[model samples]
Target: MALTLVTGGTGHLGRDIVDRLVRAGSRVRVLARTPGVRSNVEWAAGDLAAGAGLQDALHDVDTVIHAATFSPIARRGGIRPIDFFRSPSAVDVEGTERLLACAEKAGVRHFLHVSIVGLDEATLPYARVKLAGERLVRASALSWSIVRAMPFYYLLDRLLAGLSWLPVWPVPTTRFDPVDTSDVADHVVTCAFDGQRGVRTEIGGPEALDLVAFARQYQDARRLHRRILPIDLSETKARGMGFVASQGVRGHLTWTDWLRRNSPEA
Candidate 1:
């Protein structure tokens, strides 16, 4: 059986990836900052930014899925927390480089990189780091594929539901092509099982919808009616949200569409 190592396997996407690997009968190991209890997965405790215990996890591993990334904490103006903005260089970018180097040493056959769509020109710090992570994977000697996809539906779904407590929800000016996190995980496992390389694929939801449209769909799905207040978005905020929206063309089934179909009211 091949040994697969996944970094940040406790996260939303990482959780899916780890579960998929285990179901496929592959021996799995995961590197996590906070080590806790998980059956069947060999957990190696380490921080990506600090670059410790990476060698232990990579040793004798056959494939690796790089899925860990830092999302925005709070964006106030142009600056953000140093850990959010600058740490990508340390964790996503440098940590990936370290993994590639160790993979080469360990004779790892393939490297699957998890990246976000529209990082090409995104103003957001997370998107920039994702792009940088892709660059590192591409330049490495290890065989690699950069899998880019739309934002996770759960991320948007929960955020809207959480904010619905307010009288009026302020929708972001941008839009999205939200994809299922499970689908992305399936694709990652496909890459691993097929040993595919030199291939770049973009995945997205079934359709496109602006932030307001998505929120309305959520309201309808939950059987709750609420007024949405749309205000002008700052240039940065608009671009940040728009980047994810741009990927909608590559994917289908806008978040609202999925909610409508899945909701009990449907």
Candidate 2:
């Protein structure tokens, strides 16, 4: 059996992928900056930005699932736009290139990457970096699969949490198709083991909802009494995110379903 190496194994999506792969009886290795022991997986201490400990992690690994990212959302506050974009560029773009080089040298057979839907048309710095990373994966010599997923439910939860204190939730004219991270992990793991080559898959949630409606649903689920105020978005911003909202293969869970299961009241 070929050993599968997963990057960002501690992240929301990556951790699920690691668990699914383990359950499926595949040998799994995780690459992280601070590696630790899992029940049935190997870990290597590595940082994509510094290119450290990667070779050791990749050794004897036939499949590489690149799930690591320096999330723009996590680093957005108090940073210049240029710096915001640069941070992910260093990880998503340059780190991908570095990983690809090492994977090729390691003679890895398959590479799977997780990305967001419609990033090619998005103007966000995060989207731009993800698209660049996708391009790098596509250009690689090894057999590769790229799965572009909808925004995760946790992202919506974070947005709602930020606005929970406000009497009125101010939502933009944008829309989203937020899917469960576990569903995305299922697709990613399927692609990893299916022996498919050069495939790009796009996955989304069961329903598309405008920001206000989405927030309203979230508020209801949380048993909160708050008015949803629609804020007009600039055409460029709306168009970019609109493209993201409009694309992908629908997953099993709707936002409401996700909320019912994950919300505090549940």
Candidate 3:
């Protein structure tokens, strides 16, 4: 079988895809800045920003799951990147453009671009670029789909865990429908081969939760005695790159049900 190329294969969601593909016995090739190979898989070391080693890696693969992202940078007085950088336009727009051009040249069969729920690339710096990346993929001659999704549950779990260091849990007003990373990965693979072209789908967890509620419930379940303080979203610390900030709170999937099934306590 022809191999599937997964960018960011070592990342949370990307790792899920790699696991699924390997379990199904499909040939998998991952592009990494540092090559670390796994059995039944191939790793090509290069940088996507510089377009290094992309061609050599894309040689036999016809489908790509583009999951690589820049870690978000936050600054005071304004979003920090604005001083020394352009928003999503730089990486989401330009970086994706580079990938698309190369993928088109390589004759890839399908391109799957992952995006988030609320922020459109044009409006939110991060959202805008992701939106641009989708636009680029849509405009390409190759088959493509934009997977717009909500925050991943594991993301929230980690955040809550980190906040445990405080005397009390600080909750932001922002709501989240944290989708399971596995669900996202499943759909990613499905889109790659199911041949549903040019479709943009929004996915989320089984239920929505405000940060305070989520924190409180999680603490109760974990049997931790931490007071939960709710704060306004605007007052919350900014999440920088690779961090999933809440853009919207809903998805096709409900986070509540997913949480019940896979709570840290469970």
TM-score of each: 0.81, 0.91, 0.78
User: Model 1's lDDT to the true fold?
Assistant: 0.74
Q: Please give, for residues 176-195, the per-residue lDDT of candidate 3 as tens digits.
A: 56678888887777767776
> In TM-score terms, which candidate is top?
2
- Candidate 3 segments exceeding 4 Å error: 73-91, 121-124, 232-266
Ranking by lDDT: 2, 1, 3
- Candidate 2, superposed: residue stretches over 4 Å from native: 75-87, 234-236
lDDT (C-alpha, whole model) for all candidates:
0.74, 0.82, 0.70
- Highest lDDT scorer: 2
The candidates, ranked best first by TM-score, are: 2, 1, 3
lDDT of 1 by residue, 164-208 (tens): 678878777565677877777887777666756864677787766
**Judged by lDDT relative to the true structure, which candidate is superior, 2 or 3?**
2
**Per-residue accuracy of model 2 over 158-241 as CA lDDT, tens digit each:** 868777888987788676678888988988888887777675668888788777888888888888899888998875777565
| lDDT over C-alpha atoms for residue 241 of model 2 | 53
